[model samples]
Target: MPRHNSTEKRAARLVQEITGEPYTVCLNAVRARSLAPLAARGVPRNVLDEVEDELEDAYGLILDLPAGAAPGPVAFREPPVAGGRAVVRGEEP
Candidate 1:
């Protein structure tokens, strides 16, 4: 079951009343508000691109992929090193 705080429950109720959408959809919409400010800022193209990438990761947004392409299993990756190279699991530095 999805956990919702009191504030989220109230917002979802209001949204459902206004739009007549299902509770789950309304709740998801309310949850998406976290990204609203960033989107409304009209950020520059380059900056918006970067921000969108980070927000997508943070918010678990679905990434656009090529048609008919299957997504691979999630893998853990090591943090970037000083020179900005990423280290995958089981690989030496």
Candidate 2:
């Protein structure tokens, strides 16, 4: 279950404001469990459906490929090593 706190409440409110969505609908969106929780949380039926559709679209991207596919290595360059110490390559203080 998702944790509830002042920060979450504030965030939900902000989402509502930016999306022009009702506060309760935004809360429902956040509490969604396979799209059913949104219904119980008082989200308008049409908006809940739209939210579910968007969520599914985004979730699909999170797992676009089937398992057992060899994923590419994470790309990162190693920082400079000087006498077993990491050199501070960033801007000077």
Candidate 3:
């Protein structure tokens, strides 16, 4: 069991508050997004490496984001037309 420092604990808590995920999962996501910036700011390489290890350990616990949260490419499908009437899949006639 890895012991988290005060800064790490606070980071995990803040991420959980924003993302509604467990601390470990939030930590992994936050670390993944912040590693490069943190390294650029002169944070030690060894510390960053530890964070990477944590991310790898917690990878499986990360939750799937809601559909609207991370939208993928929009695919445009041809409208269905029958008997001179156009039908939209989820709209009322």
Candidate 4:
């Protein structure tokens, strides 16, 4: 029988089961490597640099709009006629 450390064997088995890939050499020898570049083309560099430039150039002002600011005159004008009768006049029920 081979003298295999139980911990090492368990670690290798776990990695294989989790990754669904068989462990070739040893448990401690396994290494985690980036698979994004292989799976998909690597992300483009300087992606945020372009956005940073635009953000630095952008500028705006914050205005303190007063409360109860009506766009036009706030008068109690009679409402227009509806259904051939003025609703404000109480002519139509």
Candidate 5:
């Protein structure tokens, strides 16, 4: 669950403005950004790394999944090249 804090809200909003992604995704991105700074501040590295890895899999880094997979398990890897148009929902056909 994301915190309902003003700073996080603002950062999520900025992410949405720049990326045009859904608010949920933007919020996830914002939350994923905290681990590095917190680790830098002397927080427990192992726990933060684990949680950060999960969060990144959820939103930040794309992983190559098998065809028809529901993005279940994750390994940090480059996404395979594929061609498809990202249709904007509000755009005319």
Candidate 6:
């Protein structure tokens, strides 16, 4: 019999029983979860930078934009069309 049966061993055994996986596989999953956050730390900033560049190339004035944020407000309300007709540019209704 083993001299020590710690919490980690018990948790691994429980996970293996529930998932039908090997004890070593269940223990490795816990280790992987601990390192996930640091591995994906730069993901949010990278996505923001890409969106900022794309918006700047299109809309020039994104109103109420924060001091140092991407100009992501790319939509504006056009004047409502009369009789529910589509409004074409440079054409008088």
lDDT of each: 0.43, 0.40, 0.42, 0.29, 0.41, 0.34
After superposing candidate 2, which stretches have Cα over 4 Å from the reference?
1-3, 33-93
Error of 5 at 46 (Å): 30
Give the per-residue lDDT of model 5 (tens digit) for 1-93.
545676666656554443334567656546555333333323233333444454445445321222432321222322222432122223123
- lDDT tens digits, residue span 22-50, model 6: 46654543333221221132212322233
Error of 3 at 80 (Å): 39
Q: Candidate 1 at 9: error in angstroms?
A: 0.5
Residue 82: error of model 3 in Å?
A: 49
**Candidate 2 lDDT, 1-93, residue by residue in tens:** 657655446545543443344567655545433334334433343443444455445433111222333322222223324423222232323
Of candidates 6 and 2, the better by TM-score: 2
The sequence of per-residue lDDT tens digits that candidate 1 reaches over residues 1-93 is 657676666765554443333567656645665323322332223332333454355444432332443322333345455534333353224
- Comparing 2 with 6 on lDDT, the higher-scoring candidate is 2
For model 6, state the Cα shift of residue 43 in Å: 26
- Residue-level lDDT for 17 in candidate 5: 45
State every prediction's TM-score relative to the real structure.
Answer: 0.34, 0.31, 0.31, 0.25, 0.34, 0.29
Error of 1 at 74 (Å): 41
Model 3 Cα lDDT, one tens digit per residue, 1-93: 665556556666554443233466646546445544333333333434444555446542222332333322222223333422212133223
